[model samples]
Target: MVWDDFAINNLAIYLLDKPNKDRKVALFVKGCDSRGVVRMLQDNQIKRENIYLIGIPCPGLKDPKTAARGYYKDAGSVPEAKKCEECRHPNPVLYDEILGTPVEEPQEKDRFAEVNELEKKSVDERYAYWTAQADKCLRCFACRNVCPACSCPDCMFDCTKPRWLDKEVSTEQNQFFHMIRVWHVADRCIECGECERVCPAGLPLMQLNRKLIKDINELFGPFEAGLDLEQRPPLTHYETGDPEELM
Candidate 1:
């Protein structure tokens, strides 16, 4: 099936549960989804020989909420999703077969532009800004559920034994929840932006992810997770020349 704006679900996450490991399967993938597949392959979560990948270049999906607001004259004129606008990879990075002619990758934009602006503010200002955003969170976990990078068998939030977080939805608790989740996925997040899209609270979750990505890039010398199957994540590997700021 051809993926369009309506097909926003990340198929890579579903394919992780291979009922019959020996049975081969094939699925269509967009630029971001293909990266997630490669990531699973790198982690040995899925076998490359067990599946066929059909890659397709993405022109970008439109925001359904924006479309519902009568923002476009026609469906074809709908504005591109904010995440797609900042996407550096519109063409699939890995595939067994390509569905159509590859499109040229868009020029790299300031992906961390918003993050940089927030950093210019005072510590208290930044804290207040994030606190306000966190207060609106419903704790629905839709963001966590939709993220392809969050493949943890037992997410901390759902663990009742240790009860990492109390059931109360206070501002402090909310912020703590979000911060911990972001840090956990900092090294592996592919920036698919699915978390933000699925958030019922309309929180700008991508801003937080982009902030971590920007910091990691600056400190670790420009690493992009899931791009190379052989490459180790910055957090998982160490180098003698690595920055000592964290120390």
Candidate 2:
């Protein structure tokens, strides 16, 4: 099976659910997908010994949806996928064997530009802006379904025992869902932008994730998720010297 796209974490579930414990699986991965593999490994969801990674150095990928719109005569005319536009890791960071020459990484740009702008707004203004965005949600779970960080075997949103969320889709419930999801992946998100890319509502989901990402960096010191196996996520790690602003 071939998936030609910017992010490939949607396929990660298959890797995590390997039927045979002794069987080894080989898979092709690009920059973001490789980080997803690392995510599963670091999260202890998968074993490195059971899989072989064939990494591809990605230059970038064009949005297939944009291409499907038929506005462009050539592939070059299609815009690079939003996920790839700010990709800091164009080469796979983890792999058993790699293919192709490593492409030069894209020039660094502020990943939190939208979050920074949102931060400039007053609390009420920010609340209003996000409320509007939340109202547009369809509760389709596209964002959560596409996220590699949302790898739970049984997601709370689907639970009937506790019924965490009401069946009715209101702005409050939608906002609550997003808030819970964003915080859950705050330290685990790989900055792949897949959630925003797949959203049919065109909601700026990445902005919400990046807001927490920016805060995490400032609060925990500079850290990028899914990069290093040795590194523990700031939220999971404790230090006596850590900031205690609320206390």
User: What are the Cα lDDT values of the candidates?
Assistant: 0.83, 0.83
User: 1-247, model 1: which lDDT tens digit per residue?
Assistant: 5457756566788766657345788878888888888777766778899889889888777777768877577878877887788788878888999988988898878888899999999999999999999999999999988777887767889999989898999899999999998998898899888899878889999899988888889888788877888888888678888787643
Cα displacement (Å) at residue 39, model 2: 1.1
lDDT over C-alpha atoms for residue 49 of model 1: 90
Query: Over all chains combined, what TM-score does candidate 2 have?
Result: 0.93
Candidate 1 runs further than 4 Å off: 18-23, 69-73
Model 2, 118-181: lDDT tens digits are 9999999999999999999999999988787888868999999999999999999999999999
RMSD of each: 2.0, 2.1
Candidate 2 off by > 4 Å: 1-13, 18-22
Candidate 1 to truth, TM: 0.92
Displacement of residue 22 (Cα, Å) in model 2 is 7.3
- Tell me each candidate's TM-score: 0.92, 0.93
